[model samples]
Target: MYGAETWRTTTTTIKKVQIFINSCLRKILNIHWPDTISNSLLWERTNQLPAEEGIRKRRWKWIGYTFRKSSNCIARQALTWNPEGKR
Candidate 1:
């Protein structure tokens, strides 16, 4: 999930990332083979947000940080810029 906040995520993409996260967490918790746990419980134990929610939060965090920058900043301008013509 490195640089995931910058990704243009789709449902498939988010699902894949979520699956990976869950598997990793399960391994870290030693919840292997015959053992099982619900995703909600896993998240609770790990104190983790769902992949989509986490990514959205990171994206918005970046946006807010950029917005607080000086007006001349390129990232802030990219977010706030309006085109005068249709693409």
Candidate 2:
């Protein structure tokens, strides 16, 4: 009787479980296509163009948590956080 009850529960839940697992696997294996525009000479010309006033004035915030410490140490850590200079 116990085995029969467990079998019934598992059969009822199997479809829902399979759907959830497939959805998760789909996202995990998702692919991103490369930008064709960025591959062209137009992309190079755009990059070489001077920054507009608004673009130049825009300030990027440093992301990541700050602990209670000396300002100098925090500043140094922020600088070293992304040596590749990614925003």
Maximum-lDDT candidate: 1
Task: Give lDDT tens digits, candidate 1, residues 1-87.
Answer: 677768999999999999999999999999997999999999999999999999999999888888899999998898899889888
Candidate 1 runs further than 4 Å off: none
Worst 10 residues of 1 by lDDT: 1-10
Model 2, residue 42: displacement in angstroms?
38
Which pairs of residues clash in candidate 1, taking residues 3 or more apart in a chain or in different chains? none
Instruction: Evaluate model 1: give its lDDT.
Output: 0.92
Q: For this target, which candidate reaches the highest TM-score against the unseen true structure?
A: 1
RMSD to true structure for each model, in Å: 1.3, 22.1
Off by over 4 Å in 2: 1-8, 31-87
In the range 1-87, model 2's lDDT, one tens digit per residue, is: 112212323444645644444444434445224432332233244343212211222312122323344556855476457556567
TM-score (all chains, Cα) for each model: 0.89, 0.25
